[model samples]
Target chain A: MTSLRHRIQAAAVAAALAIGALTACSGGGGGSANGPIEYWLWDSAQQPGYQKCADAFQQQNPGLKIHISQYGWDAYWSKLTAGFIADTAPDVFTDHLSKFAQYVDLKVLRPLDDLGPTSDISDGDYQQGLAELWKGQDGKRYGAPKDWDTIAIFYNNAALKAAGVDPSELQNLNWNPTDGGTFEKLVAHLTIDTKGRRGDEAGFDKAHVKTHGLASEGSGGGGWGQTQWSAFAGSAGWQATDKNPWGSRFNLDKPELQNTLSWYFGLVRKGYMPSYEEIGGANAVGTDKQIQSGTAALGLSGSWMISTFTKLTDAAGKKLDIGLAPTPIGPSGKRASMFNGLADSVTTLSKQPENAAKWVKFLSGAECQNIIGQSGVVFPARPAGTDLAIAYNKNERKLDVTPFTQQVKDKTTFLFPVTTNAADIAALMAPRFDAVYIGSSPISSLNKLNNQLNDLFKVAQ
Target chain B: MATATPTQQQASRRKAPTGYRDDTRLALLFILPALIGFAVFMIWPTLRGIYLSFTKFNLLTPPKFNGLDNYIRMVQDPVFWNALKVTLYYVVLNIGLQTVLALVIAVMMQRLTQKTWLRGIVLTPYLVSNVVAAMVFLWILDYQLGIGNTILAGLGLDRLPFLSSDTWVIPTIALINVWRHVGYTALLIFAGLQLIPETVYEAGKIDGASEVRMFRSITIPLLRPILSLVLIITVVGSFQVFDTVAIATRGGPVDSSRVLQFYIYDVAFGRFQFGYASAMSVALLAVLVVITFVQYRLTRAESSDLA
Candidate 1:
C-alpha cells in the first residue's frame, strides 16, 4: 500500500509539472513582433465608442489590430503600475492629467512630438487649453487629446416642479461664500422632510429627510473635488495650485476653499443634502440612482454623466426629465467648472512605436472624434466634434448639454491641477476631508493637510 | 531459512542495509520537488523583500541602497502608528469573538443527533469568495437602503453606522470576519472533539461525575493541543486582515479602519513608495513572529504541565 501511494504521488507531481510547463509556454507576450497593439482604458462607458473607432482604424490599416482592455478607475491605475514594473505594459493607453505627470517623470511614456503627424495636429484643431494640458515639464507633448469634461448641475425636472421651482430659475442661480446666495435658498426650498416640511420651514425635521435638495459625490475629498465641490470653490476664486503642471505649492489651505467646504458640509447638517454617512457609506449609491429613486432633487455631476442621467426612470416607470444648468456663479461674479480631459499616450516600451503612434493619431483625429461624439458618452476634445456631440444629444437623446459646452466657449472653466506627487497629495487629504465632512474635525484641519501636501510637492521639486 | 538466536536476529534487523537505504533515498526524492518550490517561491521572495526594505525603490526606477532610511521613516510616521493600533484592535476583537463562538458551536454540533447535513451548510460561508462576501455585507449594512437598517427602522431603533463611523468600523469588520471564518474554526474544534474516546465519558459517568466536571477534567485536558493550534492560527489570520476592510471601509471616516496591510498597500501603490512599504511589511513580519513564538511557548508549557 505504501509503495502504491508513493507511485501515485510521484505520477501526480509529474503531471502537475508538465501542465505548468505547457501553460507557461502557451502564454503569449504582449507587443511582440506581429502582436496586436495592446490598448488599455478605464472608462467602460466609452469602450463601445472606442471599439467602433478601433474597427475603423483596422479597416484603414488592414493587417494591424488594436486590442482594447477596459478596467475600472482604481484598478486601472494599480494594474497599469504593476504592468510597468513587470515590463508588460500596454503599447497604447489612455492617460489622465492627474497621473500623466508621474508617468512623464518616470520616462515610461514616449514623446508625441517626433511621432506620426503630431506636428500636423495643430493647437487650434483641438479644444482650447486641451492640447496644452498634455505637455510634460520638458515642453514635449506626451499625449494626444481624446475628450474633455466640465461640471454642471443635473436636476430632476419633476422634483423641481413639485417644489414649485422653475427650471430656468436654476440657470441663473448665483452663490456667495456666506449665505450661498439664491442657490442655497433653492436647495432649502426643494428639500423635504418625512414630515412633509421643506428645509426652509421652521417645523422641518432634520432627522428624517425624505429627499435631499442636492447630492454631490461621496465626501472622500482628495486634493480636489472636481465635480463635487470644485465648482463652488473655483467660482469663489480658489485655484488648486500657484501654477500649472509643475507647481510646488498647493492652494488648498486658502480661506475661500475652506469656506466652500464648510458651507457644503453645512448643507448636510441642515438636511438639505445627504450626510457623509449616507453618501460615502458602504451602501451608498451613485447620484443618478439617488435622483431616479426620488431621494435627491439635484446632482452636481459632470458632462460625462449626461447619458447616465438621460436613462434614469422614476417609480412610475416614466423616464425622469433631466435638466442641465450651469454651475452657480460665486462671489467672484463668474461661474466656474473643472475642465478635465483624457488623452491617448504611446508607451516608450512599445515594440512598434510607429504603429502605436499612428493608432493614437487616428484615435484623436477629427474622424474618430466625430464618431465618438455621435455616441454622446463625452464631448470630444476637438471643437468640431464638441458641436457634433451637442447636436447628437439634442437630436437623438432630446437632451440639452449646452451648459457643459458653454463653459468651454465662455472660458469660465478652470483646469484640473496637473502636478507630480498628486497621488500622495490625495492620500494625505482624503482622511482629513472625511473628518471635516463628518463634522469630527474643523475646516482648519485642511491647513495641516495642505502643509503635508506642500512638503510632498517640495520633494517633487 | 535458518533459525537464529535472539541477539543475532536483532543485529540482522538493524543491519538491513539495502532496504533501509533505498527507502530513505526514495523518500528524499519524493520531497525534492516541494523543497525546490519552497526555496524558489517562498524563501527567495522573503530574502528579496528583506533586501528591498533597506533600499529606495519606486518600481519605475531601479532600487538604490538607502540603509535604514525606510525603517527610520516608518518610526516617525503617525499613520504607521495609527495603522499598528488599528491592526492590533482588529486582531483582538476578531480572535476573541471567533474563538468563543466557534467553541460554543462545536459543542452544540457535537450534541446534535440528527441533521448531519447542517455541518456542510454551515461551511457555505467559508466557501464564498472574500470580495463577494464583502459586497453582500456592504449592501446588507447600507445606512439608508440596507436590509439591516430597514430592520432597525422597523424595530424603532436608530440605524447603526457600520462602515461610516470611526468607533464602529473595526467592530463591524471583526463581526464580518467572525461570520466568515467561524465555521472553519468550529470544524477544527469538532474534529478534536470526535477524537476524544467515548469510553472516557462512560468512565466519568460511572464515577458519578457531572457533565461539566467530565468536560473540565477529561475533555478540556485532551483538547488542549487542538485548541492551542486553533489559537495560533486565529492570531495569524486576524493580524493580516485586509480584503474586507479594503472593500467595505477603505480605511476611511478619518482612517479608523486603516490596518497595517492596507496602509502598506496605499503607501506602495497609491504613493509608489515601494521600499517604505517593504520596511513596514518587515515590521509586521517581526510582530507576527513574536506573537507566534509566545503562543508556541505557552502551549508547550501547558502540555508539559499536563504531562
Candidate 2:
C-alpha cells in the first residue's frame, strides 16, 4: 500500500511539472492566437507618443493588439542582439542608418521591396541625400527614414546674462584651436571663479578649476557625432572608408585626420573642455549635471535634451532655462554637423509579415510622424511632419527647434558612414578615443587608427 | 508429468507476459517530452547554425551557403590574429592572478577562524552577476567622480589613467576580473583546505614540526587535487572572458584590449561571418580541451602517488 502511494505521488509530481512547462510555453499576453503584436522601443521619453500611434493603428485594425516594451538605449541594443540570435527579433524596430549596415549584412532585416515599390517615397518628397540613406548595398531599402538629429550647442541664458554678455552673439561663434574664438570670450566672461577670476585670466588654475567654461568633448566621450571624435574625421576631411555609401579603402592615413584629433585633444590639453576623467559617469548625465549645477557655463548637446533639462525643477521647484546654438566649426573653415536618422524596419523572422509591414508603413506615415513630432521625441523625417515639429517647439515648448531642421536643409551635415563593417570599425574606434580622452595617449595616435581603419575596410571589401 | 508441467510453465513465462507491454509504454511516456525538447531546442538548432555558418546567411534572407570561403578568409584575417593574441594574454593573466589571489585568501581565511563573517563578505562580489559588477567597477574607476582618483589626490598624487592607456587598460581590466572572481575560487580552495584533516597537522606537531614545515608537508599535498581542479576551471573560464572586456575596455585603445571573444563577436555580428566565427569557436574549444586534459593528468598523477 505504501509503494502504491509513492507511485501515485510521483506520477502527480511529474504531471504537475509537465503542466508548468506547458504553461510557460503557451502563456504570456501576446502568445495567444489572434493576439497583439509586440513592439520594443528604447526611449522612455518617447513611449507616450508611440502608444498614441499604437492606439491609432489599433483603431484602424480592430482585431490586432500592440504591446510595447521600453528599455534604455544600451539595454535595448543588448536585448535586441540576444533576441536576433534567438530568432525572436521584434516584428518591427527603429534602425539607425549608421549601424543598420551590420543588421543588413547579418540578413536579419526584411527588405521592403517585396512589400511595395520606391514610388510611395519620391526623392522630391524628402530632404536631398536623406531618404536614400536607408538603401542597402544591393540597392534594396531596409529602413524607412523616421527622424533626423544634428549636433547643436545648448547653453544657459541666465548664466550668460549674469556674466554681462549677449547670448545671441554666440549664434555663429568663430572658433580656432589657439583661441576658443568668440566662444572663448563668452565662456571666459561667464566663468566666475571663487576668487573672482575667470578661465581666461592669467592666474586661473586649470588643475583646480572652481568653475569650468565648457562641457564635455571627444569621441566615446560625449556629445553627438559632431562633439565626439568622429567629427574630427569630418574636420580633417577623413571619412571612415573613403568614398560614398561604402568605400573599398580606409582613409585613416589622412594627415587631416591626425590634425583633427590633435586639435580636438587640444581642447582638454588647454583647459577648454573637461577631461575624460571629469566627464566620467553616464553618457548623458555629465553635460546635464554640469550645466544644471551652474558649475559649468556652456554645454553642447542636441535639441532632444531640452525637455530633459527644462523639466528638471530644482529642490525648490525652480525650472531651468536652456538656450540653443549651432555646433562650433572645427578647423576645416567649414562647419560640418554629423547627421543621424532612424529607420523603420521589418523583421524577416516575423510570422505576420503583412501585419508587420502595415505597422511599419503606419509608423512612417505622416499621421504617426506628426504625433511623434508634437511630442519632441525626435526631429521628424517627413517634410509635413517636421513642420509640426517646428510649430510644436515654437508654440508648445516655447523653444526654437529650427537649427536642427535647418541642418537638414543646409547640407552641412555628414551622415555617419553606413557600411557592412561599421560595427567592427566602431569597435575599433571607441577604445582609441577613450585612450586619448584619459590622457594616457596622444591624439597623434590617430595615425595608427587610420592605418587600422584601412586594413579593416580592405578586408570587408 | 510434474516435471513436464514445470517445463510448460517456464515456456509460458519465457514467451513474455502482457504486463511487459505496459513497461514499454511507461518508458516511452517518460522520454517523449525530453525527445521533443532536444528536437526543438538543441539538435534542430545546432544543425541549423552549422548550415547557416557555411552560407552568406544574414538573418533577413534565406541562407545561401558559400562553402569553405568564410574559413579560408578567416586564415588571412588580421583582426583574428590580433584578437587571438589579446585573448591569450587575458587568459594567462586572469588565470595567474585568480589562482594566486584565491590561494592566498583561502590560506589566510583558514588561519583566521575568528572572522568567519569576513569570509562570507569576501565572497559577495562573486555572488553578483558580471553586469552588476562591471557597472560598480565603472563607477569606482570613473576619472573624476570615482574614489580611485579622489583617494590618489588626497594622498598628494596625480590621477592615474585606468582605462585609457593601451599599456594599462588590459592589466587594469584583468585586475578587476581577478578581484571579482577571486572570492568564489577562494571559497572552493577553502573547502579543500577544510578537508585537510586536523589529524595530519596534529601528527606533525607531535613530531616537533614547525607550522611552515607542516603546511608544506601536509596542506600542500592534500590541497593539490582542489588546486588542480580550480586551475583547470579558472583557465577555461578566463579563455572565454567576454563580459569583462565588453563592459570595461570594450577591446579598445587601438584594440589593445580586444580578445578572441571580441573577435568572434565582430566576425559573427559585425561582419555576419558566422561560419568564420564558428571555426574560431571550434579552435578555442580545442585549446581549452588540451589545457584541461594536461591539468587532469598532472592532478591524477599527484593524487595516485598519495593513494
Candidate 3:
C-alpha cells in the first residue's frame, strides 16, 4: 500500500511538471527592438489595399517592416483589449470613432499633435470635421483620419422593376414621423407575398413574405445599425447627444426618436421588413446576401460595403443590378446620415513609437488614401481621394456611389456620438432596442432605458 | 537467519537517515519545477487578482486603490444581478439534464461493456473545440435557414425560435452544453462503475435480489464519489460558460442569456472596468467555493453513512 501511494504521487508530480513545461513554452516576452511594427485592422475587404500601401512604405524606408493583421469586427475588439492587458498590443491599429474615446481615457494612445508627420498634415487636407473627430477631451489629437463612410440606400434594380416602380422614385423618397410619407409607401409596394400580391393589397399574407421591402438585422438603430435607421432618426431631428465627443446627456428619450423607432419597427409588423427573429439570429443571412438572392429589394448600407454589394451575383451567374440612392428625407425637411470615419492610432506602449507614427501618417496620407480609393472599397477622407473613389466605382464596377458623397457635400451628415462610456451606453440600450424589435416592448420603453443610460453617464463622470 | 520484527525493521529504517534523505531529495527534484511554475503562473496571478479587486484598473493605467467601491458598485449593479440569476438558471438546467442523461448512458454502457468503440463515438463531441461546436450549432439552429427549423417546417409544425426568443435562448444553450459534455461525463461514471467489484452484486443475486434493487442499493451507494465529482465540475463549468453564449446569442434578446463570465468579460474588456470585473470574479470564486464545500460535505456524509 505504501509503494502504491508512492507511485501515485510520482504520477501526479510528472503530470504537474508536464503542465509547467507547456505553460513555459506558451508565454512570450514583450516586443523586441528589431521586430516588425505590428498593425491591426478589422475590415478584411480593405486589407489588400492597405497591404499595397505597406509594401510601398517598406520600399521607401529601408530596414523597416510592417506586419498587418485583420480580424472580424467583434473578435477584433476582444483580441485588441486582451492584447493590451498582456502588453502584446499592436504598435498601430485602425481606430473607430465610437471606440477611440475609451482608448484615449485609458491613456493607451500616443497623442498625434506633436508627431512630425501628423503635425505636417493641414486641416484642409481632410474633409470637414474629419480631423477634429479624433481629438480627446484634452484637445489633443490621438489619431490620423484615414477614411470616412456615410449611409445610403442600396437597391436591386431588377426587384424595383419587377414591382412596377420607377427606379427614379427611390431617389426622391421622403418620410415623416406620423404616416411614413411616400418612402413607406414605396416600401409597401416593393414588398411581395408568397401568393404574388404586393403588401399594399388587402389579400397579402403577412406570415409568408416572398420578398421583403427592406433588409435589416432588426436592431433598428441600436447597436451600430447606424446605416439602418440612423438616417431616418437623424432627419427626424433626433441627435444621439446634444453635442458629440463629450456629450454627458444622451438624447435617446426625445419623442422624435421614439416616433421614428415606432414607425421603423412597425414595418416589421406590416410585413414590409423581416422580423427581428428572422434576421437577428446568429446565423441569419446578411443584408448583401438577401439583396443578391432577391429576398430583399433595398438594404440600408454604408459606402464601405459598396464593393461587396457590387460583386454579388444571382443564381444564374448574372450580376446583380445594384443602384445607390440617397436616404429618404425626414420630417425636418432634409436628409441626414451619420458621417463616421476610421483613423489610424499609435499605441503608447509601442517599442518604436516614431516608426509607428510614420506608418500611420503614410497610411492616412493622400498618397495611400488615393490608392485605397482606387480599390473602391471605401471613400477616403481626403476630398481628392473621394473623387477618385467615385470615378473608380463608376468606371470599374459600373456602380455609382455618389449618393454617399452627396451627404457630405450637402452638409446632411451628423457626427457619430463620441462618448467615453460608449460601450456601457450600448450595453444598457442594446437589449432594450432588441425588446422593441421583438415587439415585446413599446418604443417608449427607450425613455426608461435612456434614463438608465444617463445614470451610467453620470457614474462615468 | 530469523527476519527482523516489524518494529525492528522500522527502527532500522529510521536509523538510515541517508536513505530517507535521498528519497526526499528525489521527490523534491521531481516536484520543484511544478512548484516554481505554480507560484509564478497561478499563485502570483491569484494574489494580484485579489489585490486588483480592491483597485481601479483600466489595463493602460496603473491600478489605483479604490477600497470597497468596486464591491459596493457591484452590489448595486443591475446587470451583475441579472447575470448571476442567468448563470444560476443555466447551472440548474444544464447540471440537472446532463447528470441524469450521463448516468443513464453510463449504466447502459456498463451493460454493454464489450462495445468499447461506442465510448469513442460518444466522446467525439467532447473532443471538438467549444467554439467550433458552438458555430456548428449556430448554423443548425438558425431561425430561418437552419436544419432544425427546416425539419420542423417539413413536419407541418410551426418553426421554433431556437436562437432568437428570450424564452428559448438559455434552455437551447443549455441543451447544446449537455450535448457537448454528456459523453465525457458518462465515461467518468462508467470508469467508476468498473471499479465496483462484481462479487457484492453476485452475493445480492444469490440472495434472490432483483437487478433493480441491487442497482439501487449497491450501484448508487458506490457511485456517490464519482457522482459528486461530476456534479461539482458541471456546476462550476456551467457558471463560467462564455464561449458558447458569446458565439451563439451574445447574451441577446434583452440580456436574457448573459451568464456571469460573459458579463465579467463585457465589463473587463468591453467597458475596460478591470477592477470591477476582478471584484465580480472574486465573488464568483466565493460562490463556487461555497457550492463545492456543500457538495463535498453532502457526499461525504452519504458515503460515511453507507460505510
lDDT tens digits by residue: candidate 1, A65-105: 99999988877887777667666678899999989988887
- List DockQ for all candidates: 0.30, 0.13, 0.32
User: Quality of candidate 1's docking, in CAPRI categories?
Assistant: acceptable
- Residue-level lDDT for A157 in candidate 2: 76
* Each prediction's whole-model lDDT (CA): 0.83, 0.68, 0.82
Task: List TM-scores for all candidates, in order.
Answer: 0.92, 0.79, 0.91
The fnat score for candidate 3 comes to: 0.35
Candidates arranged by TM-score, highest first: 1, 3, 2
Per-candidate TM-score, chain A: 0.91, 0.86, 0.92
TM-score of chain B of each: 0.91, 0.80, 0.91
Predicted chain B of candidate 1, TM-score versus the true chain B: 0.91
Looking at every candidate separately, what fraction of the true A–B Cα contacts under 8 Å does it contain?
Answer: 0.33, 0.17, 0.35
- For candidate 1, list the clashing residue pairs, or say none: none
Q: If ranked by lDDT, best first, what sequence of candidates would result?
A: 1, 3, 2
Best by DockQ: 3
